[model samples]
Target: MSILSLQGVVAGYGSAPILNGLDLALDEGDIGVIVGPNGAGKSTTLKAVFGLLAVSDGCILLRGEDIANRPTESHAGRGLAFVPQEHNVFRTLSVQENLDMGAYVRRGERAALLDRVFEIFPPLKAKRAQPAGELSGGQRQMVAVGRALMSDPSVLLLDEPTAGLSPLYMSELFDRVVAVNRTGVTVALVEQNARQALGIATRGFVLAGGRMRFTGTGAELLADPDVARSFLGG
Candidate 1:
C-alpha cells in the first residue's frame, strides 16, 4: 500500500487556493520528487499534507487513513515529518539540541535515531556542539534534516531542501536525501532543481497551475520532450 497519498487536495492561504485538486502518492522506499514553475503549488502541497495549510477540499491519506485538515500538532504523532526550506533550525541552539527538539513528541529514548541521523550526515556529528547558525548553509540544511529524522517518521516531507547552495553542496545534499530514503522512510520533496532532483526520483510529478500535469518515473519525465520544453528549461 502507498505509505502516503493525497487525493484531490485543495488548499491555500485563507481565500486563495494554491493547490487545486492535487493528486499524489508514495509507496514505501519511494523517493517522490515534485517539480514545477513558480506558484505551481509545489511547496503548498507539502504544507497541506503536514497541516501547515488547511484543506478546503479532498482528502489526504496516511496509510489509508483520511487525515485532511488534521491539526498540525497532531501530525507528528501520526508519523509525519516536514522540513521547510528556510529557518528550519534554531540558530541559537546547538546541533544536538535542535535534534533533541524534534524528538519532543516522542515518549522514549532517541539515541538510535540520533545515531542514524549522524550516520547519514557525518558532518553533523563533528559539529554536534556548535550553534546551528554558525554553520554554513549546507551544514545547516543537514541539521534541519537531521532534526526531522529524530522523529522516526513513516514519511518525510521536504520543501526546497537545496535552495541557495553551491553546486557541490546541492549534489551532496541530494546524496544525503538518497541515504535517508535507503533507510526505508518514504520521502516526498519539492525541488527547484528539476533536472537533478528528477534524476534521483523513483516517482516524479510535474505540476503546473496547481495541478499535476505529468506523473511518471524520474527518467520518464526527464526524457519527455514536452516536460523538457515546458518545465525543464528547454
Candidate 2:
C-alpha cells in the first residue's frame, strides 16, 4: 500500500494554482525524488503535502487517511515531517536545543530519539553545544534534518536538501538521505541536481508545467535518452 498518495491534487498560494491535478503515490520505505525546472511546481508539491499551501481540489492521503486540509502542526504527530529548503533551523539555538524544539509536540521520552539523530548525523554529536548559525551549510542541513527526526516521523518531506552546498557536501548529504531512508522512513524530496538526486531514488518523477512528465525507477529514468537530454542536460 502507498504510505502517501496525492490523487488529482490542485493547490496554490492564492487564486493562481501551481499544481494542476497532479497525481503521485509513494510506497513505504521508498525514496521518491521530484526533479524539474524552477517553475515546475516542485516545491509547491511538497508545500501541498505538508499543508503549507491551500488545496482547492483532490486529496492527500497518509496511511490511507485523508489529510488534505489539515493544518501543518497536525502533521507531525501523524508521522509526517517536513524540512524546508532554507531558514530551517533556529540560528540562535544550540544544536541540542534545536532538536529539543522539534520534539515539543511529543509526549514521550526524547533521549532515545536524540541518540538516534546523533547516530545518523554523527557530526552533530560533537557539536551539540554549538549554535546552529555557527555550523557549516552541510552541518546546518544535518541539524535541520535531525530536528525533524526528533519527531519520529514515518515519512520525511525534504525540499531541496542540497540546495546551497559544495559538490562534496552535496554528495555527503545524499549519502545521509539514503541512510535515513534505510531506517524505514519514507522519503520524498525535491532537488535541482537531477542526475545525482535520481541516482539514489527508488522512484523518480520529472515535472514540467506543474505536472508530471515522466515517472520511473531511478535507473530507468537515468537510462532514458529523452529524459537525459531534456532534464539531465544530456
Candidate 3:
C-alpha cells in the first residue's frame, strides 16, 4: 500500500519553480530514496509534501486523501512527520522535551509515545534530560529522528539525514532509518549522497532538473548504466 503519493506536483519559491511535475510514491514499509545533483529539487519535494511551499498544480495524496496545499497541522494530524536535515530538533530543549513536542497533536497518550521514541533511539533514553544542542553530530541526528518518530507517523520524510556527518556517522544514521522501516514506518529520503542512499533504499527515484530521470528498485538503479554514470558516481 502506498502511504504517500505525489502526482505531477509543481512547487517552488517566489516567481520560480523548483519541482516540475515530479511524481513519486512511498509504499508502506518501503524505504524510498530520492537522489540527484545539487539543484535537482530533492529537498523541495519534501517541503512541498510538508506544506512549506506553494504547490501550484498537482495532487499530494496521503493515504489516498488529497493533502496538496493543506496546512502543516493537517498533515501532522494525519500522522505525517518531517525531519529536515538542519535544525530538526529544539536546540535549547532537552531530548525529552524535544520528543514531547513531536506528540503535540496527540492528546492524552503522551507516556506511550515517549517510550516508543526511546525504544527506537536508545541514546536518547540515556540522555533524556540533556540539552539537544550539546550532543555530538551523530547523536543530534538521532534525536532529530527520534523526535519525528515520537509523533507516531506511519510515513516519515527525511531530508539529507546524513548531510555533514563523517562516514561512520552516515552509516549509523542509515542503520537507524532501516530500523525505523523495520518497525513499519514508510520512509522517504531526500539525499544528495546518491551512491550510499541507493544502497539501502528498497525503491530509488533519481531526480534531475526537478524531474524524475529514473524510478526503479535500488538494485536496478545501481545496475543501470545511465543512473550509475550520472548520479551514482560511476
By lDDT, the candidates rank as 2, 1, 3
lDDT of 3 by residue, 127-206 (tens): 99999999989999998898788778889999999989999999988888998988889999998877888889999999
lDDT of 1: 0.94
Task: Mark the regions of model 3 whose C-alpha exceeds 4 Å error after superposition.
Answer: none
Candidate 1, 99-181: lDDT as tens digits: 99999876485988888999999999999999999999999999999999899888999999999999999999999999999
- TM for candidate 1 is 0.98
What are the C-alpha RMSDs, in order, of all predicted structures? 0.9, 0.8, 1.2
| lDDT of candidate 2 over 18-101, digit per residue (tens) | 999999999999999999888999999999999999899999999999998899889998999999999999999999999999
TM-score of each: 0.98, 0.98, 0.96
- What local lDDT does model 1 show for residue 101? 94
The 10 consecutive residues of candidate 1 with the worst lDDT sum are 104-113
**Which segments of candidate 2 are over 4 A away from where they belong?**
none
* Worst-scoring 10-residue span by lDDT in model 3: 101-110
Q: Using alpha carbons, what is the TM-score of model 3?
A: 0.96
lDDT (C-alpha, whole model) for all candidates: 0.94, 0.94, 0.89
Q: Report how far off residue 14 is in candidate 3 (Å).
A: 1.2
